[model samples]
Target: MSKIASLVPESLKSSKPSLIRVLNNKYGSDPEMVNLTVGEPDFKTADHVKLAAIKSILDDHTHYPHNWGTPGLRNAISQYLARHFDLHYDPEGEIFVTEGASGAISTIINGLCEPGDVVLVPCPAYTLYRINAELCNAQAVELETSAPDFKVTPQLLKEALDKYGDKVKVLVLNYPVNPTGVTYTPDELRALADLLKNYNVAILDDEIYADLLYEGEHLSMAKLLPDQTLYVNGVSKNAAMTGWRVGYICGPRDVLKALAKVHQAAISTNATMNMDAAQEALLHGDEDTAKMKAEYDRRRKFLMAAMDKIGFEYTKPKGAFYLWVKVPDGFDGDSMAYAEHLAEKAKVAVVPAAAFTKLPVRYFRISYAASMEKLQKAVDGLAKVFAQDQAD
Candidate 1:
């Protein structure tokens, strides 16, 4: 008999291993290593939220959940968005629960795009959008926001729109962005919205980190273009409920109704208890998020000041937990090697922004989601690395 093996799809087969996870695995065994890489919140889930999950389980609510999600969760998400973003989504028709923001992105991209359609992903960004588009057999076209300041400009949008035209199916916009920590102003988003209104592209507005705003308010893209915007949000970052695995999508009723098929095919529903927990968080965990944001703000300031003294170059973070740093001049190798070298010499690991880029670059991202003590230790290690760079 001939040997036989299952074939992995080309989209998944060629996927690169996550550099952040690679480095974490490499350096994770060290007892003293300050892993300033992953953006997981260090805070505990609110007691009330945890208790809700526990109560649900004890109350025998562990059955398979509805494909769309529990009515309570959809309603909670709708109310949460209306209260916070000044956007209204009908819980009955326009909202659908997903596994997480990641799952929701997959559902939307798979549902909205046919093969050969283009998903316009602005970089430097989380790698998921591009990779997911590839998996869906859709083209992931990256528009690199100009350097020094990483905000996407209207002219850039115009150029891409002119080039790709109707082939562009989705425009991904994630603010308080990962790695860079750059966000948009309401006026800035409005400018982009003006251009976008002319195009037929769907706006995939990812607001998973909306509650972590350390600077100006978070203005949802939906606020400017609700009809065209597919709003994605969740309780993971805000409620310290990442392990709970709950997210939701709010958008046009017809689109959401169609997307519900993809949601059902991919993942029927989140666990009932998890949805219960998530709704509780959405309803009552704003105070918990507020406290966490205050700490994250303090950590951001502390890291920026410390990096200033130590000679690591970066724009001041506006929101979210990651600080994107351009590798100082005279550093040897690309950011992956730089990161590995740092882990070996300084015993502190940071994610290379090279992982997030669609083009070549040399940058690393430090996550401030760790405790102040851990951040201080990471800073001390970074100072030594910079000193060595100067000496060399």
Candidate 2:
């Protein structure tokens, strides 16, 4: 008989392995390695949240969850947004939970996009957006936002809009952005919103790190353009509940209903126990997140000062736990090669900027999500590497 094998999905067949995971797997086993490569939070999920999950399981609430999530969760999310972002939605009609922010992005892109549509993604961004766009058969057009500060400027938006026009269906954005710790000011977002309002593109605002801001007030674009914004967030980053796999989508009724169908088809719903835990986190974990943020701020300042002393140029982080640093001159500017060399010589690991870019740029990101002790060690290791390179 002839050998037979299942065909892989075209998307998966060509997809490159996630560089973040690859680097972690390669360096994670080394005893002396200080792995600053991944963004996994060092904090444990709050005790009350863990207890809620346990209580749900003991109370026999482990059956299949509602596709739109539990009433309590949806209502809590509505209230959370209203209180923080000053944006209101009907929990019954506009909220839908998914496996994570990644799942929610998949649901929205696959649900909303048609073949040949363009999804505008800002470069040096979270790589999942580009991968998701490719999987959905839409063009993931990246506009590089590295020059003049790492932000999506109004002029850049206009240039892309003029070139792509109605073919653009969705604009994906993440602030307190991954890789680069830069975020937009409210006035900056409002200017982009003014141009966006004239176009028919919907906004996918991924605000998973909204609560981790170290400077400036966090603003939701949905507050400025609610009719066209699909707000995606979760307890993963804020409450250190990443393994819980609970995330959400809030938007206008019609579009949310469409996304719900995709959500149902993809995973039905996230686990009931996880949803219960997420509800508890959302309802009462502000203190837990606040404490974590304060510690992260301390680490952030320490890392920036250390980088300056070591002679690496870095953008001062505004929010989130990552520091974006430029490859110093006199070194070849291949971020992946530079990162690997650092890991080998200094026993410190950082993610290469190539992982997050759709353009050719030289940068790398160091995550401070580790403890202050670990961050200090990593910085010391990095300093040794820089000094060694200069000597060589």
Candidate 3:
């Protein structure tokens, strides 16, 4: 018998890499590293939310839930959507609670895409969308949104639909975007909705950061195009419940039925305790979310001011806790190199723009999710590095 040299298939070998993990592994263990690479909130889950989870566990709400989700949790998610986005959804038919927002994206990819189907993803997007598309054997056609504003304009959407034609089955839209921290306005969402309506494309709207809008309220594309939108959200960012691993999807009944099949086969169901906890977080955690958002707003102002003083050009982000700043003039525009330089010299770790896509090279993402004191230290470290460069 011939020895098996390579057990994994070529498809698995050719899969896209995880940028967050790559950066984490490179700088995570360094004692002096001030990591601004991760996209998680730095706040703790509120005491009341935690108490609710403990109460649920103590009361023995631990049985297996419905394959779609617990009825109460689904109802809570529906109400949350309606109250926030003014969108109506029948919880029983339209909602499926998943492991996290990442799971929701995976479920949609598996449910919607067949072999060779194309997914339209804007560049500098949350990295998971492209990876999920690849996992489903679908082509992720990344349309660059590195224009004056990092948004997928109606013209760009039209061009992608025309180019990919019938192969394009899904378009991923993330507002309060990771890496870029840009959120779409209601008018902008409506225009894009109209353009997408012309095609048979389905939307995967990841509104995980919807609650962190510093400038104003977040506008959901799903509100305008609910029929074709698979809206994904969760408690991870808003309630600081990343470890709880609870998220949900709401969409048309037929689409949700398909996603339920994929979800059930993959994970069976989300843990009952976590779902119970999430129900509480959704229904009674508004105050917790508000408090965290206020703190994030303060850090946002400080980071933006620091970047300006350091001569870094950046868009004034309206939502999300990130600043996408351009590298200083005369520095090599390669963000990976700059990131490594900062990490080695200044002990500050940030994600490079190249990690998000092959669009431009002058930008890097700084997460303001750390405390103000740590953020201030990072700013001072960065200032010293820039000053040293200027002197040299």
Candidate 4:
């Protein structure tokens, strides 16, 4: 191997792929495997959104667009945020489009972080935050919030701030959080805001699953802490356009200006056609999201009931299509080993909790984004696994 290969940063060289992708790769080709390890929506992009992309193509919109994003798409996103979350952002200087929410997260972390800076990440996190922080030569302090219903509380924030002090540069907040599907109520968001209001840290609020809430309304931290929150969202989850790779970052003009420089250096601009499709999703795709969300709600309910019957312990998810379930009793609390056993014996796939955080956890995350029939098959396999463990 070349010296350049050895010179690659330890963060990138040593990091493992996400557990979701690893399981998908390992069992995706298995004829009998019931893979529920990915957080992707199982819905297709809305036809209208596709048509918008086609229209953009036909209009010869294939050339390079604005570096920030097409003005029309940014305006659409501005309106979407206002309509959905009661948050306002200036489309001209405050909104920027990136490759996807993943890319947006990378940009924000890279932009704001310096060597030795600390990022407060509430676990079980999306996993990417830790990797991103490491890549930026910063440290990720995981404030384990699994005991507080997986929702970050004011007390937790206070404890993290007190310990990390001024070294803390950002707080990565994602809700309808992945893995757990727990979201904060409006009042809860306000309390967090109150605690962080005096702090110097920026809040990178990732609300990519905002449109998929089933129980209560979704609230944006940007509304409460507009000056200090970098709101990240995209059409991947709600519009089922993951391949499109269109996402936006909106925030205070000064902060966005700095983020825009990083974004521009990263990807120059997102694809023109994808931005057109995203514009349609933002402006005219609420019903499309609602339709997909209803199906997800059904799947979530069925999965919750099945987990209960199988004697697995988990909190009922209210937003994202996932369950953070404890390892069934009678088995050693080793999520990776348990997940591999299920994959080999029962032909089911799940992500071990170790993939999300460094905490010694005995839980696995299940994504219910598959069809009802597929979900039923997975439940059947899990039921067998649970019974087999109990018997042994």
Q: In model 1, what is the error at residue 308, expressed in angstroms? A: 0.9
**Per-residue error (Å), model 1, residue 80:** 1.2
Candidate 2's TM-score reads 0.97
lDDT of 4 by residue, 1-392 (tens): 88689778877887777777878888888888988888888888989999999999999999999999999999999999888889888999999999899999999999999989999999988888998899888999998886538788899889999998999999999999888988889899989999999899999999998988998878889888888999999999989999999989998999888889898887899889889989999999999888998999998899888888888899778998998898766787588988898898888998988888888878888999999999899889889878888888
List clashing residue pairs in candidate 3: none
For model 1 the local lDDT of residue 131 reads 79
Residue ranges of candidate 1 with Cα displaced over 4 Å: 1-6
Estimate, for each residue in 1-392, the C-alpha lDDT of model 1 and write its tens digit.
33543466777778777666777787778797988877789999999998999999999998987789999998999888888888898889899999989889999999989889999988888888887888878999988886776878999989998998889999999987887888999999999999999999999999898888888877889989989999998888998888888988999999999999989988888899999999999899889999999999999999999999998899777988988888887986988888878888898988886778857778889999999999998999989988988998
Number of residue pairs clashing in candidate 1, backbone atoms closer than 3 angstroms, sequence gap of 3 or more or interchain: 0
Candidate number with greatest lDDT: 4
Which candidate number would show the highest TM-score if scored against the true structure?
4
TM values, all candidates: 0.97, 0.97, 0.96, 0.98
Question: Which scores greater on TM-score, model 2 or model 4?
Answer: 4
* Decoy 3 TM-score against native: 0.96
Clashing pairs in 2: none
Ranked by TM-score, the better of candidates 1 and 4 is 4
Model 1: lDDT of residue 96: 92
